[model samples]
Target chain A: MKIRESSALILPPYFFLTVFFILPVLIILILSFTHNRDWSQGITLKNYLLILDPLYLKVLIRSLIFAVLATLGSLLIGLPMAYYISFSNPKRKILLTLLVLVPFWTNFLVRIFAWFTILGRQGLINSFLLWSGIINEPLQLLHTSGAVVLGLVYGEIPFMILPIIAAMDRMDISLLEAATNLGANRFMVFKKLVLPLASPGIIAGSIFVFIPALGSFVVPDILGGRDSFMIGNTIKNQFMTVRDWSFGSSLSIILMVLVLLGVSAYLRQGRDQSMTLGEYL
Target chain B: MSHRDATSNVGFGQGKSVSIVTISGLVFLYLPIFILIVYSFNDSRFSASWNGFSFKWYKIMWHDGPLWTAIKNTLIIATANTLVSTFLGTLAALALSRHRYRFMGVYHKILHMPIVIPDVVQAVSLLMLFAFFHFTLGLVSVILAHASFSISFVALVVMAKLSNLDRRLEEAAMDLGANRFQVLTQVILPNIWPGILAGGLLAFTLSIDDFVITFFTSGVGSTTLPLKIYSMIKFGITPEINAISTVLVLFSTLAVSSIHLFDREKK
Candidate 1:
């Protein structure tokens, strides 16, 4: 309880975070404005300017598109499931929730790798179709935009489901019965009552899905072709392969700014209401 | 009444559709994982074909030196990261939850920042930081990077538990002539031990599963399971990966289920 004691408690984590986490981010932010890979050269706007080029701009746009689509895909699949789980009996509710979350426990790269096996030319779908005599040749299911989107959506679906289910669990069911009694149709009850109440979860879920999907390198890297390049891939390339630290740092800063903006909006919205990590999990 | 009939009809229809969606959603979630697990036992070297079930891949994995080394590195990093982060995080959580301070708001924001930032950004930043300091990228760097994000997770979990804790118990301990350290060790810690355990497990899970940050920070001879798996997958899919994935998935499932069951019991 003493100030000195508390400070002692806090100082270790604070120092660790400052050195490993905070300083690195600060370095990147500084590096972003510089022209040279290392800090020896003078600072310039060239990195930011380079981002404005049509090629990089297009990759950024594609990243946004993939994220938005993945968010929508997960919502479409996850919302109804969450709704069902919310209304289920307690035993069934726990079982169903666990079932939904089990895949999420698997390693992320392994899950993406599973998709490679499922969508590859000689993979599951192709094998099934070929056995059924529906096609003579294997379809090009892998290394396409669809493959990338599927990977993103599959990877992020649990994030969507968990929060939405939490929201639905907190919802007042009596309102639904009352709406039904007041002559509202099922669709009307859902649209006017349920959807509005679950909006917080939906928003939270969307943020969870969208942010990761936007910045994902693994999904695109393993599942996508050259044409499916995303901003994450470009940034990784800039740093690792090209060894252009300044450009990589610039791209990263831009992505971070965008993500922080989204997070700030979410925080502002979340301020009015209380949600717990238990529910989010 | 006709109204009753109509409502029942709607309920029946909704039930039917909900069941359909729920069943299909479960299938969608589990199908890929199930397939991957199943193929791990396939005799075929290529994962795509069913060359009859055998444990050859698993056997190969057992004898694989590099695979074992990677697993060793992963376990080492995960264990070290878990212990260090959990300790640091518990302290931070205690500080934030137990007392109000001048810089609490700023400290809270700082804690949450790492959680929100994408892994790629975090990875590159840490990588750059190491470069700046001329620190070699290796297990130590990986541990530091993982602990950075993991501390936040541990703090969040522990703080949630801390906030829900009944403060009267601590007050009673104090009133009973128990000193701060005595109350902390005997009363406070005993109560929050579950949270700390859960936080530690969660940190362990995240640390082991982490690829992006580890990928960036790992130097030669520091290939963790994920980095190793990534390289294998890039080279091409092999049943060896399937075997590895299966084991990891099973371990993770056990870890996560225990976390859930622990929390459920507490509730």
Candidate 2:
């Protein structure tokens, strides 16, 4: 009776996940290696090797450049915002926090489209400049790398802010006082006391921003000109236009590997920082 | 007294830091969005400048069929995804929290992977997986894809509530000869129902806002609102897009905030 009841409790979710989620993922993994170009060629390593080519390497570098810039931008902006909210009056904190999240509730595509109105040549910024007698022609702000980064940082700022706020809220306020009492100046207190304490939050926020930015498709596709194609756009094109599922699978596997490496490296650095700090202090 | 003194010193400089930070943060966060909203009303046909405010774009948005269809489809998918994910997610949470899970570590990690995995990769992987299995991209694929991610989020949030719950009440009920089902329904459900509701609302919002996964899994005819907006933006910008976006932003803010308001009301 006990055994029967136990199984019944676990059965539904387990069965649901296994059938719909696990099986599909496993099927994709299995098909990734099979070289069924003509449905009879069987399994091979050609797809994997194809991914290691110079062309893909360039694409991989391009994605890293975009993601890194966006992550840095989010950090520069999000850190201070998080600090404000974390240190603010408890009553007003909730309202400010809601500001970060409210934008996220709207569809991402709509938000990106909104950027079009602002950044496009005939859009607001250029028009404002033209009207102000600054320039006779509209500035070519749209369909550029800058626009791609702007869209990415805009979309991901909340993701970066939330984690940093969580970290900041948990910080030991006494440490800041200790640093100040020890004759540390304001900049010294921030650099030595607050930055170290917030490293974990920064790390977490960076991961949250970096990973998504790396694989973001819509921003790059819409805002980026032909020169701004990331690996994400490549994979998207493969399946949608090239009609090549196998090649897309290979790209997915490579992206997964790169993401894992990046995350692991980030965690390692975080771990090392804490370890060295522990040793020094 | 020592702790209080230390806290006061830290609090002293915090105000100046906060005011400076708040203004900068607001500019960083809202400048782009503000530019977009202002340009939506511009009379100028091509640029982001304030040519003049007009309701012409709003009228155009009303006449657009694709936009309406996308919104309708997104609503349907969000509703369906919420219901299905909430049911499965709540059950998963219950199983994790109420029982001593054996493979708990593995289960938790697997569920969290969707959130951690880049959406672009997941999009491609799902598309490849669907094609491999000969599953066609349509409403069904998108629904399943959304539910898969939503379940994890729902489970995580519900689990947070469950962990904070006192087990003594459930233990007492069980000790009084109540069956497990009766105890779960009468004892646990009422206490955790608020969190479950909040989780369900979040799932709905996520489903509605999702674009990347839906973009890949949705067939040509089954355009969700985000996908429709994506296609439209590639060609050109219009005022109707702005009007639709303004309405979308307002609706989502109301939807998400209401969940928090409801939660606060209980407390």
Q: Assess each prediction's global lDDT (C-alpha) against the native.
A: 0.86, 0.76
Candidate 1 segments exceeding 4 Å error: A1-5, A38-40, A274-281, B1-14, B263-267
The TM-score obtained for chain B of candidate 2 when compared with the true chain B: 0.92
Per-residue lDDT tens digits for candidate 2, residues A235-274, read 8887789866667667777787788787767757755442
Best by lDDT: 1
Q: Would you list the clashing residue pairs of candidate 1?
A: none
**Model 1, range B2-115, lDDT digits (tens) per residue?**
222233333521466767987898888888888888888889887656799898999988999998999999999999999999999999898888866787789998898887
Candidate 2 regions off by >4 Å? Answer: A1-5, A128-136, A178-182, A262-281, B1-18, B48-51
DockQ of each: 0.48, 0.44
lDDT of 1 by residue, A261-281 (tens): 988898787767636453353
Assess every candidate by TM-score: 0.94, 0.90
The lDDT of model 2 is 0.76
State the lDDT of candidate 2 residue by residue for B1-267, as single tens digits. 234334433662356765686788777666666666665676766553357788777778888888788888898899999999999889888876677556776776667666667787777667766776789888888988888778878888888887778888887888899988998899889998977887898888888888889988999667998887777776765666677777777787897688669767977
Model 1 C-alpha lDDT versus the unseen true structure: 0.86
Residue A275 of model 1 has an lDDT of 67
lDDT of 2 at A76: 84
